[model samples]
Target: MNKKLSPAALTIATVVIGTLGLASVPAAATRPGRAAAVHVAAHFDLASGQTPENGVLEPDGSLDVTFSVARQVARVDPDGGTHILATMPLPADGGANTPILHFAPTMGIVRADDGTLYFLYATGTADLTGVWRLRPRQTPERIAALPADGLPNGMALDRRTGKLYIADSVLGTVWTVPVTGGTPTAWTSAPELAYSAIAGANGLKIHNNALWVSDTDDGTILRIPLLPGNRPGQLQVRATGLTSVDDFTFTGRGDEILAALNHPNTIVRIRPDGHRTTVLNAADGLQNPTSIEVRGTTVYVLNAAYVTAEDPNVLVAGLRDLR
Candidate 1:
């Protein structure tokens, strides 16, 4: 979901989603001293509504991705081949009631060690809006129901606790539910997570015994400690001035992270001290980059092209800093 603009403005912007445009790599993207050689690992068919919104990378180098507009989940291999895993049915109302996007879209995904996939689906209807699970070879099923009035954008699974945390972009709420699927609980609702004009609480990750959330509207990242008995501690602002950050992942090097700035078409490395560095940008074939996944020194970025309406692709690059 490339959502830097308000719901009203984004709806108007979709009028141009069908128009394609050529992109020129910025001079900074290819300037001297930039060490990463970013390349497209997979290219999606935008015409088929294949906008890769978010994904999780598997150990075998395969990417499990959600096709936002098509309401489908797919596995993209290293060789650029795609295999459809599951497809959510179209809502009867054509998704007109969907909170922000106004279209039933699938977002956020996490893969379990057992090859089970858990993802979010929001259709503005109680019947289909919630957390869904796909087992190895079974049909996708809704295990937990979320508020249809909210938009679940990003999620993280805490394997140690058997819990899943979901971020609601519209209601500005963080929800927690069991991995086995049941009713969801409103884990927290702080002011920093409230949406201003656009959205808040856009991305989420469980790292270092804490839950880190990104507020797209406020351009800030917050950390909430996971206390004993799963209680949430005081909120702490970790980083600021990060507008348009949709989803992020920790670099596994302390508190450092790589975040996707959707509107800017850039990905940045944010240090624990609030320092930021532009890691990749338009020159690196980014078209509204949405989410990031890091495995060792390799970084995978998913481009939704929701704003650019151009090439929706998955870009892979080596992070020299991580090396």
Candidate 2:
């Protein structure tokens, strides 16, 4: 489940943000043989106070982002023009004293080849929390509901099978929901999938015919083989000792992975042989980055900037050929 800050904690956070400002380390000097080049594609103005969490790349080169605080989705074009795509509904049970900040429609989003969008969001009520589908020129439709305590965070799609995989940080479980709106079933359950102190089983992807998941609280990445019927086999640890791994994407090389280490404010490249390298760090101007998407040779990152609550930006970089 998402951790709620106490009044005292919120006050402390505000104090810290006020004191530190939004200072970030400068990008490292480029080297002749480096495998990647990092730079900010767009900087979100703090005046807007948009706290974006996750995003997916559209075929037209625009990026669709989810704003957790604003409870809306917007499309950021290649040139940084943001157009609102949809505004999520407010929770039905929002009471007079309820903090609107606590309602996060969904932290995870995915797009199908047909341009349909799917997300996992919560409305602070059992009836409003679940997987939802949003097609162009249509209203958002609820596809499936999670358990009362389930908080959906990361998602993965099996394109070939039209099955969507949802990761619930609160319950530490993954569910398989049909793309066409049907019942969702538990696809896997293990100690590794359960939340520890904070979050677990975040950021999922279908790569090389297997399921790759990030165990955020445990600081590890796990791989589960996909069987003939889209069933998951035993879980295997792929990488470990990561720092607050949230969402990740496969690089051009099928064996390598790029992940957002949220707490450390860095992006890491996990090699096929299990070694890891910091591709981009705070010096590259990343702040609480939550999701990563690589389209062609361009890599896009969503910086949530949750700590300082300032300058939340979408960063872009170029990936050197890994082949």
Candidate 3:
């Protein structure tokens, strides 16, 4: 689940933005590696709880998104059509027992090649808090139960290894579960992943035989190598000073990253050497940007508007010279 920014986080965001020296500039203005054009691809109903938290791009150009507060998973078509796939049931106690955020939230979501969709749901109860599986034409079911006190924030599926990696923000631990669904094991619990004030490990992705995670409270990106026998090697810090980063994606280049700085309301490209460049900002229709997806020369950004509480939408931008 996403969190409201505290005073300390706001202070850090100011420092980070000032350090980048990129403010609300014109969308067409040229920067080192900024997007050439940005436009709203879809607008969601914030009042109705259609805020997009995380998303996955479908092969046919559809976007599968999890509506966090709505506790629903829906697909947004290229033509701006929304089709509800599954809606998680409301908790019996009306989510009073929900961990951290105090409401049942459907967070990260990923689609398998076989057309099955897997997502994370945290309701602060043993029975309802866990990873969920939604097969085509079938109702959603809980496949793995996570700790009730922990909030599973981000998730990634390793196609090569058939394993799913989950980031428990409250617990500050990374868990590994088989795609077929069973017991979830604690893959790694590091100090770097623990929360200092806000959320801990917020976003996760597997790239180049390594697992990449974002620490929301720490404002850093971490990398863990996938060793032989599906074991984790060492944890390494990839980038820092990225305040309020939620989810990120690689630019198809070696190790360059485009991350969503949620509270900062900007998208930055972090290089392998830790140098950062602001690519998109509030001028590009960003409202608490949560996650991003890149395909070919286009970038899809999700703006949840959780804090802004206005104009929740998805922005599409052109990667002018990112190649």
Which number leads on TM-score?
1
1 versus 3: better lDDT goes to: 3
Per-prediction backbone clash count: 0, 2, 0
- Cα-based lDDT for every prediction: 0.83, 0.75, 0.84
**lDDT tens readout by residue for model 2, 165-238:** 98877678889988997788999976897776557788889898798899887888899998998788889999
How far out, in Å, is residue 94 in model 3?
1.4
Which ten-residue region of model 1 has the weakest summed lDDT? 19-28
* TM-score of each prediction: 0.90, 0.86, 0.89
Residue 240 in model 3: lDDT:
95
Model 2 weakest lDDT span, ten residues long: 94-103
| Per-candidate RMSD, Å | 4.5, 5.4, 5.5
Q: What is the lDDT of residue 253 in candidate 1?
A: 80
Please provide, for model 3 over 1-323, each residue's C-alpha lDDT reduced to its tens digit, 9 standing for 90 to 100.
Answer: 23444332233345434544645323222344344467788988775677798999999999999988778999999987888899999889767677657678899999899989999999988889999999988999999999999999999999998899999999999999998899999999999999766689999999988999999888999999999988898999999988878999998888999999987789999989999999788766788899999998889999877655557788888876433
True-structure lDDT of candidate 3: 0.84
Model 2, residue pairs in steric clash: 1-170, 105-121
Q: Any idea what lDDT model 1 has? A: 0.83
Give the candidate number with the greatest lDDT. 3
Instruction: Please say which candidate is ahead in lDDT: 1 or 2.
Output: 1
TM-score of 1: 0.90
> Residue 61 in model 3: shift from native, Å?
0.2
